[model samples]
Target chain A: MRVFRKQDEMTVKKLVTYLVLGFVGLFMLLPFLWMLSTSVKPASDVFTSFENPIKAFVPRETQWRNFPRVYDTTRAMGGGFARWYLNSVLVAVVVTLGQVTTSACAAYAFARLRFPGRDKLFLGYLATMMIPGAVTMIPNFILMRKITEWLTVVAPMVDWDASRVVSVFGRTYDAGRLVGLDSYFALAVPAMFSAYGTFMLRQYFLSIPRDLEEAATIDGCGLFRIFTTIILPLSKPALATLTIFTFMGNWQSFYWPLIVLTQDSMKTLPLGLLSFMGLYSTQWSLLMAGSMMMILPMIIVFLVGQKWFISGIQLGALKG
Target chain B: MAQTTRGRTALAGYLFLLPNLLGFLAFTLLPVLASLALSFYAWDLFTSPRFVGLHNFIALMRDRDFWYYAYNTVFLMLAIPVNILGSLLLAVVMNQKLRGIVVFRAMYFLPSIVAGVGTYLLWRWIYNPDYGLINTIIASWFPQWLSDGIRGLGVEWPPQWLTSVTWAKPALMFMSFWTVVGGYNMILYLAALQGVSPELYEAADIDGANAWQRFWAITWPMVSPTTFFVLTMSLIGGLQGGFEQAFVMTRGGPAGATTTISYYIYNHAFTWNHMGYAAAIAWVLFAVVFGVTLVNWRFGGRIVHY
Candidate 1:
């Protein structure tokens, strides 16, 4: 009787655990499910009565054209969804590449080389991380504006038309609009040098054994060559984590882009989606469709790098 | 020969660090210092800066909206404790050995992954007072008599979430809880849980301790380090957050009900071009964060077990 009671209690506990997990999982997924359902629903089906919640989620008929409609409508509204998507991709890719390269080189130096004031300089970088972005934002905005003014003055001297148009990937670009407030340079350049990335990579680099580097040094390999062939190849997981993080961050960046990129063409996905929301505030179906597109890439990136992402967070937290 | 090689190594180190250091100095370090100096000078972008010692700081002190927004910022951070607790609970549950647990964890983490303006927009639709999902669910699930009873208490049947002043901050807090409860905090706790020794739990079982007792005595203290870390990090983040949410959802609201300190800073600097005042406000915010962090470390270090 005692054994039977124990088994029954264990079964009850397991059942309760599964029930809690299932219920919470459903609660977590409900909003995404609603978003997917609403994106396919017709406009009339959106504001359903409170009689049947299940019926509210299930559309009368799928409106697959809502996606294309969102695309075309946003394009016509001067904030092209495609253009924003492309810009987000381009900026995220460039920023990730730039950040990884710079951080790795800096990390390699701090980890492997002996230099005066190296630790002090690294501590300075770490200290800056504690300063809130709010303090720096105003100054950065002013700097961008000053740079734009300087670029405008220099463009005429260099015989470059500020309004000249060029085409790449079938998209028109203002060719001379480089390294200024509304340009890609402003969007991608400043974001490339991250103190957080340098710190994380430096921690990882410190863990790598010195034997490999020593062996390569005896083989007459240069420092850059050792970094490229040994340190980087060994630190793939750390590099991947930083790449995914920076890409996701830049992709969904809103505030800086909103401040800098007033031109509709230069806006990223988050700003573009905000403007779309403003224009179609009442159109729930179209707004949901745009939102779905906006988050799809992020979801994909997250799923792909899910392993490295979780481990990286744990690594940083534990080490720090 | 050794000296020459040491010099060469230093040169290589500096060369390697040049790209990042130059950018960091120009972008981060310089701006930080400039922001501090700019706090003492009044400049409206188009005009030359004029020195005004302590004027901006004094003006900020007298500004009623600034105080109210600071209140809003603190009020919004009230969600952090609840979020941390929920994350801890969820992490404890997820640390169990079960079938397809990874899938469940991923589902819980999906909201945080999709967080940004997109998620904010989705919540805006969900929080719509008229035809929103929450209200619709509540209306359908609750019997008419129950809602009638609620209305009899002289309360609104469905809360006007974003539109109403009293409900807006709570609404944003609710959204934040949902987004963050199963996010990185949970993962960190899960990692912490995995690091706990099974021998302790076995000893507790041998002592005839109940499940709840085991948790409080063994699991809780064991994970206090992670708890401290999560609390400190969340406090810092929560104090600075609510900018994107306010900007996207409520435009700082019907009556500035949702405006956070960061949003206030943005309006002052960007919209009004009061660069000096904004910098002053930002410095105050930094002071608060720094003070809070120092307090956390001083007090939290005592409570954490190793």
Candidate 2:
């Protein structure tokens, strides 16, 4: 009788724990569920369910047209949905490529090479990470403006027309400018070099065995060749982590792009989405549809690379 | 010849570092120094900069918005402890051998991975006064007398969340906590919990310790280091936060109720063209962050168990 009582008590405790945890878990998912519900909700019927509390989570009739309508009309203004999507992809890809390539080279120098002031230089670089991005934001904005001004001043000397379109390497640009506000050059260049990327990669590089480099050197491989063949291939996991981080970060970046991209057409998706919010504040369905579109890529990436995403964060935390 | 080759190898290393070093100098290092100098000089982009030593700092002291924004910032930070503790509790619960727990963990972490702006937009709609997710529930399910009683006590029912000064900051904090409670912080805690030796728990169980006792004695101390890390990072992040969310949702407002120091700095520099004053605010923010980090290192290091 005593044993049975003990088992019953344990069962009750477990049951209660599960019930509490399940309730909390639902709350975690509540916002997303609400977002999806609102997206499919008809414009007229969106609020009708509010008369019933439990009914709020379910839509009376699903308006799947809401998603397509986002792209069909002027409500998708501020350079349209397509332009913003293209800009986001372009900036994220170029920024990721630049960040990874530069960080890898820097990490290689720090990890394997001996040179004067290397340690001191790296320490100085590490110290840059301590300075928050907000502090540097103003100066960088000023820097961008200064560069644009200089380009404008020198445009006449090169017979360049600032307002005219010019094409190079299948990419179009203003014939008059190299770096200016609302330009892709302004967006991609400043984001390329990352101290955190260099630090993370350098740690990974240090863990790689020295024997591979030594054997390559004996086989008459130059530094460049060794780095291309030996170092990079061996460090694919670290590279992937940095790539995803940089790409995701650039995709989601708001402040810098918001400040820099003054023209509607030049705006990235996140910045473009803000204009949609401001214009369509009353239309919750359209807003939800736009938001779902904005978040779709990230969700897909997270789902596919969930393993790397989780492990990479854990590695970063361990390093910190 | 060998010495010459050794020198050449060093040159190659330096060559490899040149591109990143140049970017660092131009973008990161130069801007840091320039911003520091700009803090003491007044310029509005069209005009030449003029030095005005300590004037900007003094002006900041008198600006009421600065103080209000500072308060808003600190008020937002009140959620940090709540976030850490909440995540810790969730992590402990998640460490159990429950079925479908992996799915539960994924569901919980989903919000954190989604883009920030989307999350904010979701909450903005949720906090809608008339038909929002929150107010809808309150309107239908909540007893009328309870709302009337609260109103009789001088508070409004189904509060105007983002638009009302009284509830804006708290609403933002709630959204932040909800997003972060199951985020990377929870994962860190979970990892730390898994690292704790099972032998200690077994020994405690042998001593007739209950679940609560086992957690308080063995689990808590074992996870203190992770707690320290989370606390420090969260504090740093908290102080610098509110810029993105405020800029998007509130634009720092219902009469500047949600203007954090970061948003204020952006407003001064970009919107008002008060570049010097903005730089001064930026420096002030940096100093506060640095000071808090120092305090955490000094105090947190001692209490954090290995």
Candidate 3:
């Protein structure tokens, strides 16, 4: 009887846990479900379907064309969703690749190679992580503007047309507008060197056994060779974690991009989506469709790299 | 030979660090210092910067709008404690070794992963007064008398959530809670819980301690370190946050109901071109963050167990 009672209590406890979990899970999922439902509904149905909760989530007929309609409307408004999508991809990829490479190289130095003031320098990097982005925003903007001014002044002296045009990937670009304000350089360059990434990668690199590097050294291996052959290969998980994080961060980045990119063509997805919202505030269906497009890649990336994402967050908190 | 090799290693180290160092100097270090210097001077982009000593900081003190926005920032941060507790509870539930728990964890974490302007926009739509999800549900599901009772409490029948001045801050807080309840805090707590020794739980069982007792006595103290860490991070982040939400969702609101300090800085710096004032506000924000972090460390360190 005692044993049976204990088993019953255990079962009851498990059931209670499941009940709580399920309730919270439903609360979490409802917003996402509503987003999907709204994305497929006609504009009129958005306000009407709310009278019935079930009907609100299940449209009478899925407006499959709402997706394409968003593309059309945004394109008509001077910024195409496809262009913003490509820009987001390009910026995220560049920032991620650049950050990882720079961070890894720096992490290798900090973790392995002994140098004077290395610890102090690493500490400085760590301390800057606490400084808010607001402090850097104004000066950086000014810096970019100055660079643009300098380029404008020097372009003519070098016999180059600052407004020279080129086209690639079916998109037109000002070939001479290589760097500075409102350019891809503004979007990708400043973000490429992250103290957080360096700190995280350095922590990971410190954990790597030094014996392999030592052995390579004994065999007359150069520092760069050992880093390339051994450290880079071994730190794949760390590299991957940083890559996914930086990509997602840059992809979802809104503030700096908003401040920097004034041209519709230069706008990223978040900015594009915001402008789309501004234009079609009343059109819930189209707005939802635009948002769905913006959110889908992040969801896919999260699902694919969730293991690293979760572990990376945990690793970051370890020091904190 | 040894000295030569050491010098070569140092050279290699500097070489490896060159790219990041240059970027950091130009971007972060220089900008930080320049922002401080700019705070002491007045410049409106086209105009030359004129040093005005402590004028900007003095003006900031007298600026009623700054205080109001600072209050708004703090008001929004009221969600942090609730979020911490909610995530802790969620993490406790997630730390269980039950079947299909990972799916539930993933579901809970979904909102946080999708957090951005898109999520904010979705919430804005959901907070729509006439046709929003919450009001519609309340209108449909609630008994007429209950709705009337709520109406009697001075809130509108379907509550003008994002529209009403009184409800806007609360509405944003609610959205913040929903977004962060199962995010990094929960994951951190889950990691912390997993690190706890099962032997302690066995000992508690031997003492015939109930679930609540076990949690309060053993679990709480064990996870205090993580709690301290989470609290500090959340506080710092909360202080700096609200810019995106204010910009994307409310545009600093119906009547400046959601204008945080960060948004205030943005307006001054970018919109109004009060560069010195904006820089001063940014520096003040940094000071507050620094002071708060120090206090958190001082107090939280005492409570946190190894």
Candidate 4:
């Protein structure tokens, strides 16, 4: 009787676990699988009935031309798709680098250094994260307009208040005003420092045991040396985790770049996608093609670096 | 390590923190305070802000679209528990002694890493009324189950998805599920699962506690802290309901069926450039989120085991 009960109980557990997991995995993966299928599928396969999952698996004709078209200028119009992609990459890279560096230095000080009102200051920093970005939109924009205007100081000299000069991209435009070269700095500079990263990293640092720091101090290590040699080495896992998330997020950023960048060459990926909608109309084929190109890089990164994402979140639990 | 001296190290810490401190104040703190003042005024993008007292707040109380977005946002919140449960289940399934679990997990998480716009575009195609993969398969064998007259035009022909009020909330909620269920929550649960003690399971096996009882008594409680965090984060994020999807998917369309509070605020601020009124909307959201979070914490304090 006991043996019978044991067998019955184990089977129920197994069944429950599988059903629960099956339902969830199916939901999470449906969208991505659908995308990959859409990218590679032909037109007939593009729209079947979504009510059923089976049609998604079948392909009618594989329209591969769409992928390359997403890269071409005729499709993109404002400029070459490659330039927009390149600009986005450059801006995201610069912004991510600046954010990590600035945040790390600040976090280190909050964690290891001594300063006045340290507790109060840290509290103040945490408080900042609660504020929504909408509050500062107009102010920041006005600030940027003023700054960008000042940057164009040379535009007047170039214009000579007389004539315009032609440049290599083959267009003769006013060299007149000091308008900046539609620079990436306008996007990257403002986003470089963040209160969020500081809060996350500072929390991670506090969880580290103090014994390691003491040992470094015993070795007559200077503050910077201790930071570089001890703290940084120990924080590798956390930093890597932050890098992936911040990189992915910034790479996908849209609104800020849209608001700040008026020049054609300055648009980021999300804005690039948004702009595509205006020219493409309702063409699903081309839109999917553009969407695929934009998403593929992030997919590749996440696939190769899945461990860090888990490690990053788990860090909270492990330390707690 | 010894908590150091009350001297130069502390001084250096302050110095190191200055950049971030200044940044937070300049960018975040000052704006929050300024927004409070904005909530009391009327201002446009071109003109200077004018103080008008609590008029914006009173206006918010009566605004129909504002209430509609709140109602829709509440509907989105209902999906949270479902999402959390679904993700936890996925984690448990993938966490098994199965082969190629890592790849499966990666595949599962793929949607989340992609840009939200990209995800929306892909889903839009899938949700198309005519040629969408979803309707196609369902239509072939089970005609009754499929929604009729799909244009095969994909989103050009999508079933008024995310745009029609009746279906907009559900569509947005479905997309939210598609976007995050497996990919977003799965990673966190998998982490929590790995931490569950094998010894406890072994002990439960020996103690005549059945698998069901073991899960209830041992596993469930162990994962409560993660559950609380996930719950809180989801509720908070759900309230905001990321603007990109609504902005792109519905544009608060079909008579504004899908606008969440965040999208409404975005419209007022960036679209209409109603800086003062937009600030007011933002404050209201902050209050709602803040208020809900406090309530969660108060209740959470009792049951969150970690």
What TM-score, computed on C-alpha atoms, does each candidate reach? 0.97, 0.95, 0.97, 0.85
lDDT of 2 by residue, B23-42 (tens): 88888999999999999999
Q: Which tens-of-lDDT digit does each residue in B103-192 have in candidate 4?
A: 567666776677477877777666665666555654565444233434342322324565455666777777777667766567778778
Error of 2 at A248 (Å): 1.1
lDDT for A96 in candidate 2 is 97
Which of 1 and 4 is ahead in DockQ? 1
TM-scores for chain B, listed for all candidates: 0.97, 0.96, 0.97, 0.87
lDDT of 3 by residue, B1-306 (tens): 999999999999999998999989999999999999999999998888999999999999999999999999999999999999999888887887899988888888889988999999999989888777887787788799988888889876677998889889999999999999999889989999999999999999999999899989998999999999989998999888899988998899879999999999999998998888899999999999999999998888788899
Alpha-carbon runs more than 4 Å astray in model 4: A1-30, A40-60, A73-76, A145-183, A209-220, A316-320, B1-11, B143-159, B199-213
Error of 3 at A3 (Å): 2.3
Candidate with the greatest DockQ versus the true structure: 1
Give the per-residue lDDT digits (tens) of candidate 1, residues A1-320.
88799899878988999999999999898989889999999998887674767888888899999999988998864448988888889889999999999998899888889999999999999888878899998899998877757655766565322434678899876532566577788898888998999999999999999999999999999888999999999999999888888888888888898888777777889989988888888999999999999999889888888998898888779544
Order of candidate numbers by DockQ, starting with the best: 1, 3, 2, 4
DockQ of 1: 0.82
| lDDT, each prediction | 0.89, 0.86, 0.89, 0.71
TM-score quality measure for candidate 1: 0.97
- With candidate 3 superimposed using the best TM-score fit, by how many Å does residue A44's alpha carbon deviate from the native? 1.9
Give model 3's TM-score versus the native structure: 0.97
Which of 2 and 4 is the better model by lDDT?
2
* Listed models, DockQ each: 0.82, 0.71, 0.79, 0.47
Per-residue lDDT tens digits for candidate 1, residues B1-306, read 899989999999999999999989989999999999999999998999999999999988999999999999999999998999999999888888888898888888989888999899999999998788888888778778988887899876778899989789999999998899999999999999999999999999999999899999999999999999989888889888889999999999979999999999999998999988899999989999999999999999888997
Native contact fraction, candidates in order: 0.78, 0.63, 0.75, 0.67
